[model samples]
Target: LGRWINPDPGGTIDGLNLFRMVSNNPLTLRDRSGLRGSGYIYVPFLSRDTVDIAIALYTQKYAVNKKPDIVVFSSRNEQLDFYEELKKRRSDFAAAMGKSLFEKYNTSDLSRKSLLNAGVKETEIKSTIMSIGNYLAINSMTLMNQQDDEIFSEISIGDKLKIIGHGSAGSAEISSGGLKSVTLSMHELAERLDFSGLPDQALQITLLPCQSGDELLEPVFIEGKSPFMRTRPSAAESLFYEMQARGYRRVTTAGYRGFGQIRGFLESTGSHHTQRKPNSITASDDIVRRRDAKEIFC
Candidate 1:
């Protein structure tokens, strides 16, 4: 809705060219503030392309796959929950690793040396670690995605399982069904994703087109009640509101429950050992949800 944001009507009516799309390439215009139109206006956003390379990678992977596929119904809930739980379970995981390989991982402090003691390869641990408040900033973007199916499209129910997680090691070899423990390095995860038929360029311009007469790809995203811990990205909600304002119908929602879609996705892929489906219901929007940003932030 760039056109809707056009405050000035002085432009020509023969299809106004008010907001020119800056070439997706990098530009120095943002650093140079002379381009700022007025005290209330700035062009920093023009330099940042809204395209999502992650989604593009998925679409590219989908295009290259030639084999028959079993499209599953699990949403992205399980993995999201796993990640959230991981943050809480880090110490536990470290303890487990330490018991397996001591001295190298426990360096008398929770440091990079701890990972080394835990038998984590040098590359698995980040070269540098930084923390802000309660959040520990890592060296990778992570294995997060729209759904677990997006990552495991190459595997099936009865195939030999080769799985990966942000932390763990060794491909587990067992009977027909058992949870394996193999950790994933950040760089390794990105590399594996590249090999998974996901185009590397998808990270920059992952686009999905509309049926027709629509300018942008629109998706319906059902979100959880907690804003701070939402499975879907923040942009999805903004787009939903923008589409709503544009009179679009058919709002997109996840599986039945608010936070259950992610959980379902995990259970579908054996990510969660005690996987259980979420229970949800159809409901109308709450008008007061928008009054305060804090209402959703947490």
Candidate 2:
């Protein structure tokens, strides 16, 4: 029953160590009396503790994340004949990060007196604690083209779109030149775009099996697509609606049910992977959307 998480945007770390869910409004912090009142500025004095965390700020006001030039994550179990649950979650996050790095060095020998007692300076605490210990090896990838279902992400298929509104992609790879490069790259990307990157229609969902158009080269299917009795919207919702109908702003890709995508992921309630949703059985244009997150463009 703990919370306050908020990290993992691109992931690096800042808000974690949860046990949240508090708000009765008494969580105060305000003071500003200037003029004839002489002077006052105080601020934030929230209190509540049977075991309250009450820390609105002051871990040096956090701001140190960004370490992913590229980290697709994958130990390879694309779920075809599996590696038994990614080898049991990579051996349980590597034995709970080696028992929390041996109780975090039992006492402390990080040298330079715990990096000036945490004020950090000793040459940036060995590159800031090995860069937040790299999210314990940022490992979690599963798309080896699932033996030809369909997926070929490199990103880029912009400039010709008719105006968002359509969907279809299926297979598990029996191959026909990977279904002619997934219908010759979606009919040369059924509309075209590439309007200056940043999420300008982030397309690339190819996994061939043959028939509609044939021509291949491996990747008939793997972890990208194959077993679809129904539902779809996984290529991050057609790369966020072909980059928000060609506008090029910020939020690059996020569709399948809006604001922050994939229902803002927060699972782990005994973790069996439910709560996903997003394939709303037909009726097109996301008929009012919901089942997760949305907003491929507008």
Kindly list the per-residue Cα lDDT of model 2 for residues 1-298, writing each as its tens digit: 1233344222222212122111312123122321111110011111121001101111111112212121111122323223343356457545655655534543356642244345653533443343223223233222232123222223222211111111223211211121222122322232333421223232222211111111112334458668433333333344444444555433343223311111111111122111222344453454332322333332
lDDT of 1 by residue, 179-231 (tens): 43232222342333334433211011100111000122234455764334223
- Candidate 2 wrongly placed segments (more than 4 Å): 1-118, 124-128, 139-296
Identify the leading candidate in terms of lDDT: 2
TM-score per candidate = 0.18, 0.19
Best by TM-score: 2
45 Cα displacement, candidate 2 (Å)? 51
- Cα error of candidate 2 at position 148, Å: 7.5
